[model samples]
Structure formats: structure tokens, C-alpha cells
Target chain A: MYTTWWPPITLSHSRRDQLLRALLWSCASVAGLMLVCIVAFLILESAPALSHPGWRRFFTDAAWHPTEDAYALWPMLAGTLLSTGGAVLLAAPLGIGTAVFCQWYAPAWLAVPCRRLIELLAGIPSVVFGFWGLVALVPLINQWQPPGASLLAGICILTMMILPTTSLLAQASLAQADPDALRAAAALGFGRWGTLRRVVLPSCAAGLLTAGLLAASRALGETMAVLMVCGNVVQLPSSLFDPVRTLTANMALEIPYAAGRHRSVLFVSGLLLLLLVISLVGSATWVRRALRHV
Target chain B: MNAGRAWIPLLLVLAATAGCGDSPDARQPLTKLSITGSSTMAPLIAAIGKRFERRHPGVRIDVQTGGSSRGVADTRSGLAHIGMVSRALRALEQRDLVGTPVARDGIGLIVHNTNPVGALTPRQVVALYTGGMTTWRPVSGKDASVVVVNKAEGRATLELFLKYFHLTNAEIRADVIIGDNEQGIKFVAGNPHAIGYVSNGAAEYALRHEVPIKRLPLTTASAPPAAGHPAPSPLARPLTLVTTRRPPALAQAFIAFAASSHVHDLVAAHYFVPLAA
Candidate 1:
């Protein structure tokens, strides 16, 4: 509160706040600009395609047929949800466990190396993972299933890719848990796992959720590896081994040669992706608000 | 005198280097026609653009190869002045969209040179891709799996190969994967148990495996033959220059020029068959 504590500037006290506010405003505007640009392009591009009953069929129907133009999103949506859900299912437990290991159980000597390996795996390019999965992982998976590159292959890849971020965040959150609470729980004769579950994990729930959201975004926008491994068949996915495609992969694959309404349909697909992401964001915001109220 | 003489030689070398860097007026920067599409059409489009620029100074043509499907889509969305595709126009292709044939490219199945199985019937290739033949045992007289390599999904090659062969829902064995054309070639060359198909232009005939891995013959498409294009139709499709609307004047000029007989010979020399009648 003292004058010496003030930021250095030859201006009135209000100037600093004004500059800070302007900087924040500009940063926010830049991000908003990207969203606006995508929306504008999507609306304009999809206008032609959306005019037809085919658009409704595409959005509502479960089937997709390029030969007959019976485009549909239900099957694709199901595939997307399944792959992403499977990824989350695998990643959540491992991520939390790894975080727990890093935050509490793992020897200090092993922590950095373990984290680094996870990071390196995640940092490897998606295309590299695609090649590796195709060359190495899928073949292994095929030992059980006759053919590989199934939804399961994609999920495994996504899990491996998402692990580093999820674990890192969970680690940070768990690390930030109140020491006093853990000490009290220990004093009360609670076991280490008991304290971790009852107290530490509850406190870190917020960060864990954040990690989940980050992984979700990765699963959604993921194009190359999933495209390579997901068998790209358009029927409703029946099992984890079923071949599938994601919205982004479809756009990447189809956008090149599509014309007129078909091109617009791809953009519409993009718009659908945008809406899906926004809905997730909305839910995340709602969760945060509810958490704050609690 | 020696200093002056040395300067003259250096200047001459510099002049030659600069001259060779780009033709002073060749491939001029004019209407900025940006074309992107199939890697198969890349060389052909680049050849056409180079000739187009040489003829029309001050016009720039930017041609990109992102693969054919994207090219066609880009043209539809007006993102490209032209799109080049290796495959024919699908039923889903825009009604207003039209294409002029640049050349006919022969597609051939490629295998590891070490693969002793010299050639496959089109039926056999179809069977292999549709997951009918999973092992190299019968073909090579060895007990090993046949790694079937395919283009990425939604690729023009997948469509062309499938449609031509009358196969459906063909999946690349998750176990056998190649990232791109080059990788697929290398994978086949190195693996000794892999098979794939590539356009003749994109197919490396001079690679170490080229001689060993022979091009599998494709049966002719059922068609009424016009005079210029012969029977046994070379298993070729028309490589097209796709634009959303007719390209700007300079690009159109180049397109017209590409359709000319002079460049037509150049296309054939590059091993692309002349466009279908």
C-alpha cells in the first residue's frame, strides 16, 4: 500500500490500472477473434449445405455413405464419444495414480525421471505415435483381435498421449493439499491411503477436473494418429475394437476434394466440433461455479 | 590486371548461378493462382505451372500438394484457384464443378523387391486389401503375414482402388501401417512382406526395390473406346485441374496452355498417359 511499493511510472495512480486493464482486454480479444473467425467461416460455408433436407439427415441420421450422399453424424459422434471415453477411462486412473506417486509415494530420486519419460512420450509428434502404433502397438493388440487399428488402438494411443498432462496436473493439485489436514488425519491414526482418499484427493478434485478437460480437448482435436489407426468405417461402433473416425479426421480427409455442399458439409462438421467443445466448456464453467458456491 | 581478370570470372559465375536460380521471367508472379491437391498430381501441376509462368510473365501460380481430396474440397470452398486430383469425380462431386484432364497416370501395385511373388492378379490384390489374404505364406511360399499398406482414409487412392476393384469397407490391418506415399514405398521395400499401390508418376521406378517389386497389371475398365484412347485403357484416370469457378485470367490462360499439344507431349514424357478421350 505504500508509495514505494507502487509500480514505477510517471503517471497518475489510475494509469497503471488502465494499462493493466487494456493489456488484459487485448489478450482476451485476440483469443475471442479466433473463435469469431471460425464461426464466421463456418456459417458462411455451411449456409449452402444447411439449406437442404440432406443437412438434417446428415445431422440426425446414423448412416454415412459417400457413394449415395447419405451423410450422417450419429455414428461418428458415437465413435468420437467412445474413443474419448475410453481414453479418459484409461488415463484418469493411471494419471491419478502417477500423480499420487509423484506427490507422495515415489522416491524423490525416481520422480523427475518418471515425469520426464511420461513427458517425452506425450511430446512425441502425433504422426510418430501413429506410425509407432501401426508398426508396433497395433500388431501387439492384434494378437487378441485378428485386425488392429481398432477403437481400442486409438484409445490406447490417446491414453498414452494424455497421461503426462493429466498426471502433471494431478501431481500439482495433490502437492498443494493442506499439510495441516494431512497431519491431523495422521494424528487421528488414519492410514496413508485413507488420508489421501478422504482429504488430499477431495482438495485436489478441482485440479484433477482441469486435467481431465485438457485431455478431453486433446482427444477431440487429435487428427493424424486417430485417423491413421481408427479404421475409418462409418457404421455405428459396436465395440472398442470397432473401426471409427472422428470429426476432425473426417474434415482433414474429406475437405480436399469436397465441392459445393460437400465442402459446406465438412464445415458444418467443424461447426459441430466447435459446438461440442463449447458445451464442454459450459459444463466446466458450471462445475467451477458450483464448486465455488460450495 | 590480375584483380580485374579475377573479378570478371567471379562475375560470370555469379551471373550463371543467378540465371539458373530461376528464369528471370519464368514462373512470373501474376494472378497468384494457389492450387493444392493430390501428391499424385503435384509433379504434373508443377510442370504445368512452370510452363504457364514461362509463357505469361508477372503471373505467380502457387501450387500445393496436400493430397487430392483436400484439393477438390479447397476448390469447392474457393480456397484454391485449382485442385488437382488423381481420382475421378465422385457422385458427391459438385454438379457445377468440372475438370479438364491434364494427363492419365497409370496406377501400379508395389511390393518389396525381395518379395519373390512377382505379380498379383487384380483379383488377388483386391482380396489382399479386403483382408482376404492376410499372410505372405501362399504367395511367397513362406509362412509370414502379408502387410497390406493403404492410403489414408478418404484418400482418392482408396476410392479409386476400391471402386475399380469393386471392394467395400476395406480396412488397413491396424498392424500394417504406412504414414504416407514415401513411407509406404519404404515400408514395402524394407519389409519384404508388404504390398501397396501408387500412381506411376509417384512410383519410384529407379529405387533399389523397383526392379524386384513389379507393377501388377490392372484390368481395363468397361468402356466404349473412343478413337484416340486405345483399348486396354492403361488402368488410367484423368488427372484434372479443378477450380471453384474458372480460374482468374492468367490461370485460365495457363490451363488453356496446359491443354495444348506441346505440353501434352511433355506430360507423356513424364510417364503420365494422355488424358482419356
Candidate 2:
């Protein structure tokens, strides 16, 4: 029954399985390699700062002067978290609302073009986004502050950038909701709005959570757009109107000038960013596990 | 023969992609020369690189512009053979890394050609920027509301203007800061209500392409207008070429090319004043 078909010969079942296993192993190896690279680089570059001053200073000190050997992380960390939080808060409701409309109510003509536009937006380079933000968003914020760049400007720019990612994920989540459940709800006397509110939300809960986490991750890593709009002062942001520099912006702005112990400090900051990303991803994994248990 | 001929173009393309411009001597061991920092010194360094290539041929020179402060750090780390900068080394830098002043230049202020106001005094410029004074009624000229423009941070000319004008931590209203010098100049050039500053090397588009804007001379003492003219703007700062080391050989060679007597003519021809000359 398993006779050979050609001189070249057909692949045996075992050979096929072996090939698949090889591919799977190679993919795992690639993932392992990337993780090793990030960890090694972070440890190696951060050696100078770790060796000279205690690791406590990286978390405690307030100033980042290298000459006197200060490596404070609070001001930059606060700015990063605040701006990212502001961006998520502004974009989430709007993006989810837009996705809901597109999926449940928007006409095909409008929805299709709009979806394409959002995808195109995600494809635009960070530098281009920075220029657009500098020209379009920052000026509008300056109207309120009257002559200085501020956290609000950076937030607004980020809101526009994060919209595409959030909307895309939200739409994917909405699409994953069972249409059959909606039809059944209508048969059970539930209105379109009620069905979506009750049946749709329950079914797509995991998808929606994933979408939210994905957007948050993107907001944390965004660099150039924030740098252009944020005033780039390394200080605790007192008000939305005040200028502040985010962690990523500080690293980018100072990395070129930073060396030795200072360079190591930047790597430490990068490691901190990695830790933040890992925690977020870990939370997502835990949520998925809890969903499976349910 | 036909197949081999067909492969020639493909082979050539591959060779080009694999670093065609790389010299056979790229693998050769020679004294490495690295220059980093100061985009303002790009013209001078580029000019020097061309001449140095011909003279030494064997020695490799790498010049980079990482702003002023970055140059100092790179030099200190031994990442670069020499640092090229437009700003002065800080106290730490002087102790850690040596510095040599190669040539001198004056930071020049520029305005759009269409702008009617010719010159600004040191005080008037500051007033317009910070004190919220608008409408250029220079020491004598007719009044026109002035719009201020600024370049991105870390630009040598920008750093000098801010320091000379005493604007440290002074934020420009976000509405006016442009990404690069040319854009700022273009923004001013297109609008008669705008004014900005740039290095002398950056004057071409701001002053040359259309109408040449005048440089406002800055001095502590008051100098009144000439006849029917408003006094020149007294806002000037030195243009400097900074180095991280005492000056490595190739760096010295490049500096020689930039500072040679002929280079003086070249500098002025490009609108920069060669102080040594």
C-alpha cells in the first residue's frame, strides 16, 4: 500500500515527521538565540554601572549625571508610564468603539476603506510620524501652554499612533465573536445592541483583553513620535502642560553621549524595559491560562 | 558562452552589494583614524577627507558627527581616533580628553529674504523671543510683527545661540520648532513674518537661493543705525572646530586641509569667516 511512486521517491511518513520536527526545533532555537542575545547584551553593557555604583542607585537616584556618577531612573520611568497610560486611556475607548461600529453597523464601503487606512497608518515609519506629530499635534497643544512642548503633546501624538494597533486588534477580536450567537440571540428576542452587549462581549472577552495588552505593549515601546513631541527635559512631570522626557527618549537622546558606566546605565534601562515587557507578556499568558481553566 | 555572458551582470550586481567600494586595503592593517561629532564641521571634514585620501592613501580616516558632547564621550572611550565638535569640552572632558581648536567660525543668524526687517540688536532679539515682544520696529525700521523659528536641539549653531542669548532651559513654544536648519530657514523664507539663526555654512538656502538675509551684529555696546538703516543685530557667537585628542596624525592632516590658506578662501566663499585667516 505504501509503494514508491518515483525514482526520486516520495517522502516516507517518518521522513515527513522528521522534517517537521527539524523545522520546529529550528524555530525554537531562533527564539532562544534572540533571548540570549538580549540578556547577554543587557548584562555586558550594564556592567560598568552595576560594578561602580550599587544597583540601588539605578532605582533610587534622581539625577542621571555620569561625571558625578548618578543613575536615577524615577523621573524617566514616571514619564514613560504616564505618557503610555494616557495614550491607552485616550485610544482604547475610541478604538474599541470604532471597531464595534465597523463590525456591527458600518457599511462595507466605509468600513473597508477605513480598515485599509488604519493598516497603512501602522506601516508609516516612526520618523514620518514624528514629523507629522511635530507639525500637527504639538502646535495644537502649544495653543494651551503657549510656547513650550509638553507631556500633553506627546500623549496626543501617541494616541494617534497607538490607534491603529488597538483598532486592528479590537476588530480582530470582534470578528472572532460567533455570528451564530448573535442570530440565536435575535431569535431569543434580544435586540442587536443587547446581543452585542451580552453575548458578544462575553464571547470575545479573551480577544478583547489580548487586544488591550497588545496596544499597551506598543505604547511602551514607541520612541521617535514621543521624542519629537515631548520637550525632552529629564524631570518629574508636574502637570500635563509641563515638558517631560520619557525613559526611551532619555536613552535615545543620551546614548550617543553616554559611555562606560553611563553606557552600562543605558543598558540597564533597556533591561528594565525588557523586564516591563516580560511582565506584561507574562500577565497575558496567565490570563490565557485562566481562560483555559474556565 | 551565452549562459556565462548572461551571468556577468548578475555577478557584478552581487559583487557590488558585497561591498564593491571596499578597498583591497580595507583588510590591511594601518593606523585607524576616527573622527566623530559636530555636524557643523561636516563641510570642513568632508573637504579634508577628500585630500587626505589622496595623500596618505593607506591611512584610513573615519569622521562622524554625533553632536558636540557625544564626540567627547566617543573620544574618551577610544571609539574614535579624534572627535570633531563645534562646542567646547566641559571640565570633565578637559581632564579626561584633550582638545585642540582647529579653526574658528562665527555663528550666523539668518532670516527669510522676503522678511523686510534687515537686522536685530541683541536685546530686541531676546525681547521678541522671551518677553513676548512682537512687531519689529528695529532701532529705526518700520514695524512688522516678527515670528520666531528654531532648529532642533543639539545643533551647534542652536546650542551657541541659546547659550549666547541666555536661554538655557528656555523652551520655544512648540509651534515654531522645525526639524532641521533648512526647514526652519524655508519656513522663514516663505513667510515674511519669520526670523531664525543658522551657522554661516547653512546660509546658502536661507540667504542665497532667493534674497540674502543680513547677519545682525551683536555687541554689548549700542551701535545705532547707519543712515536710513536700523542697527545690525548684536547676536554673534564663535564657530569652533573641536577635537577630543591633542590631534592624531590623520586628524592633523584633515585639519591642515581645512585651515590651509586656500581653505580660508573656501570658507569665506561658503559664507563662513575664517578667524585664523
**Top candidate, metric TM-score:** 1
Give TM-scores of the second chain, every candidate: 0.74, 0.71
* lDDT score at residue B127, model 1, on the 0-100 scale: 68
> In model 1, which regions exceed 4 Å deviation?
A1-20, A47-51, A54-56, A59-62, A189-191, A288-294, B1-35, B47-61, B67-102, B110-197, B205-215, B219-233, B241-277
Worst 10 residues of 2 chain A by lDDT: A139-148
**Residue A16, model 1: Cα distance from true site in angstroms:** 6.8
How large is the interface RMSD of each prediction?
8.9, 7.3
Tens digits of lDDT, candidate 2, A1-22: 4776543343555655556566
A100-193: candidate 1 lDDT, tens digit per residue: 8877788989988888887787778988887777667765655556346578888988888888878887887788888899889999999988
Error of 1 at A232 (Å): 1.4
Taking all chains together, the TM-score of candidate 1 against the true structure is 0.73
